[model samples]
Target: MSRLRFLAVPAAALLLLSACGDDDAGGTTSPATAAPTSPAPDAPGTTDASTGPATVALSDDGTHLVSAEGRSLYLFTSDQGTTSACGSGCLENWPPLVAA
Candidate 1:
């Protein structure tokens, strides 16, 4: 259990750290979690490939990623691990955030 905790803690911390931002004027900005890349056929769990990567920045509260047009992106708590459970049906109610 200790071994799992040791490894799990850092992994969780890294994910948490990636979402962190400084809330101040002239504060540093976190890099986009997903950078622009050519739509490749082999990539797993890829988003819409036809569109370009969305330019995201931390929200004013520095809690989450927002789109270039200033839309707050959210994740479904129901998503299993890294795989999104939200599908065609769920999108209508909780639309997935897509940006250019």
Candidate 2:
């Protein structure tokens, strides 16, 4: 009887230790959590690809553009040409001109 009892005690302890090591992968970020709250600064002379067709504060020849957040300015090389590539889903917070 004592021999059976000793074996049972060790077996129960091993079972208990094996059950304690479960860890799930890191949690995923939701859309709301991943979304950016502020717009990124645009370089001068370079058009904001994310803005709309409405007029932006570019120079007479479109050499520079300002960010909507008013945090920084962006510039584009004269050879780069005018117009921005930012459109569609990229303009959530950085909305383009609205014909005011």
Candidate 3:
């Protein structure tokens, strides 16, 4: 009886820990709720399977490009045209507009 109880306690703890494991909270689309096969032709921007529709808007100051979702896109002056100078650490704060 004591040996059975010992095994059961650890098994219960393992189940609890597994339930608490980290989940991707970045709002990624799951297969169940994936984007539709075709976007509306009248939609304002281009749609991709992975990232959905993307559009460019002018920043409030009219200085930079903003996403349709209103996230600001920045360009590094240090980088030449169409190149990124940001490292992984910088990305944590300012995620890239394009998927890697």
Against the true structure, whose TM-score is highest?
A: 1
Instruction: Assess each prediction's global lDDT (C-alpha) against the native.
Output: 0.63, 0.42, 0.54
lDDT tens string, model 3, 27-57? 3321222223333222223344355534566
Best by lDDT: 1
Please identify model 2 stretches exceeding 4 Å from their true place. 1-4, 23-32, 42-100
Over the stretch 1-100, how does candidate 2's per-residue lDDT look in tens digits? Answer: 9999999999999999888865433332221111222333353334553443333343333444433433223332321233555554544544433221
How well does candidate 1 match the true structure in TM-score terms?
0.42
Error of 1 at 96 (Å): 2.0
Better of 2 and 3 by TM-score: 3
Full ranking by lDDT: 1, 3, 2
Backbone clashes for every candidate come to 0, 15, 0
TM-score of each: 0.42, 0.25, 0.36
Q: In model 3, what are the clashing residue pairs, if there are any?
A: none
Q: What stretches of model 1 exceed 4 Å from their correct place?
A: 1-48, 81-83, 98-100
